[model samples]
Target: MAKLFTPYKLKNMELKNRVVMPPMCQYSVDTKDGMPNDWHQVHYISRAVGGTGLIIVEMTAVHPDGRITDQDTGIWDDRFIPAYRQMVDAVHSYGTKIGIQLGHAGRKAEDANPPVAPSAVRYDGEGYKEPRALTTAEVEEMIEAYAEGARRAVEAGFDTVEIHGAHGYLIHQFHSPLVNQREDEYGQDLPLFGERVVQAVRKVVPADMPVIMRVSAREYVDGGYDVDYITEVCRRYRDAGADIMHVSSGGEGPVGAGGMPVGPGYQVEMAAQLKRALDMPVIAVGILDEYEDAEQVLENDQADLVAIGRAMLRDPYWAVHAAKALQAEADVPVQYARGYRH
Candidate 1:
């Protein structure tokens, strides 16, 4: 049997396979109320039916101002629970475990009235404006918001919850020295924000529910943090109750600082390093879209799971097709079984 189709357990959660559908923002909430409409229902359910082992819903904002765009999903209100419940129910029917990535965009919130960040600096690029620094009080409020988001995620019946601490979002802003220039505790203790958020979310979820963290292991700019710094950050997250880490790099700033080498399985080594450094399970992302490559990562113990973003977006059946290609047994939906040749 291929490692890609092997069962992997994180605490009490058991995924049927190593394939993970990492959060990729759909930005489909047309009402601006942060509700998931029909588009989201079909978008996520199809992947569940297509044999994805775990479907992590996209970056869901904990506050309206936290949205990267007006269209991003939000869990800020109780009313949004039912919509998410419906999506969860549909995905569950196909026997797939589901998770949601809770986040606040901060300086990257292009649609915000005025974005907020850990510092008053503007993101260095067009399409991004200077953001007001989050006051210490507001920072505390955001922590509670994350806790509330986790509570709502539980109410909606998700099996796991991921805190988006990567990609230069609010948590990343606080974690990255280049973006965070405050003299307060947040600046002096850079990983404090992410650690607190993890602790907050962990408190709200079921004791057995796994809390995953997505982190940028390496920033692509000079003076930007690298794997060594992020490993220590991951240590903080683990101490704060994070069960797993999803490894991805570069979003803290513009990517022009001697671009990272891009290719298949480019980020696998980072995951391997974190796994060894922290003795924790991690999800290896970044171009490990091919089944063979994903299987190799698992077989080599580089990561516990593999996340395919662009490939999964292009084809919801990326997992099902991979099962066929790898000649591994996959629980293909009964209705679609006829399409799979013997």
Candidate 2:
């Protein structure tokens, strides 16, 4: 059997396969209000139907002002519950577990509100503006926002809730020395923000619900947090209550160039590093499409779970295809069995 198709258990959650749909922002929510519309339902349901083990809903903003785009989904209000509930139900029908990635974009937040970060540093390049520094009280409120969002995620029937701590997002800004220059408790201190967010999330999320922390293992930029810094953060998050660490990299600044690298498992070394440092399961995601690559990641003990992003988007049935290519006899959904049998 392909390791990617093998069942794995994390805490109380058991995944049918290692194939996961990583969070990809759609920016498709209605302009009038941030709500999950039919586009989201169809977009996600198609993947679930394609037989992925875990499908993470996009990076939903924890607060109205935390969105990266005007059309990003929001969990701050109760109005979003029904839409999310329906989505969860739709995905569940395929026997696939679904997770929601909760985030606060912070300085990366776009739209009319501009953005806010640990410091007033502006993101490099166009469309970027100087972000207002978040005050101590505001930081406390942001922590509460994450907790509240976790509560709503549980109420909405998600199997897991992942905190978006990577990709130079809110929590990441606090971790990166390049953007965080404050002498205050939350600034010069690298792990304070992540530690606090993890603690707050633990308070609201149910004990049974798995909490995953998505982190960029390397900033890919000089003077940004490196593997050692990430290891410390992951250790702290695990201690605070993180069940898994989803490892991905880049996003230090425009110089880092998020998706410029084009190679298979380019960021797998980061996952390998974290897995060696922490006892908790580590998830590896980045340019992972081939079955051989996925198998090696597990066989070499680089990661416990393998997450696919653009590859899955291109072929929703990539998991089934991979199983066939690897000569693993996994069941395909009845609707697509004809193609597989042929």
Best by TM-score: 1
Model 1 stretches astray by more than 4 angstroms: none
Candidate 2 residues 1-342, lDDT tens each? Answer: 778888988767788888899999999987748798989999999888888899999999988878988899999987888899999999999888999999988878877365888999987757877899989889888988899988898899999999999998988988888888887899767778888889999888778788999998888665566789789888988998999999998765765543356599988888988888897788999988887898789888899989999999899887777888888766588877777665
Off by over 4 Å in 2: 256-261
Candidate 2 least-lDDT 10 residues: 253-262
Q: Scored by CA lDDT, what does every candidate get?
A: 0.93, 0.86
- Candidate 1, lDDT over the whole model: 0.93
TM for candidate 2 is 0.96
Model 1 Cα shift for residue 240 (angstroms) = 0.6
Steric clash pairs (candidate 1) = none
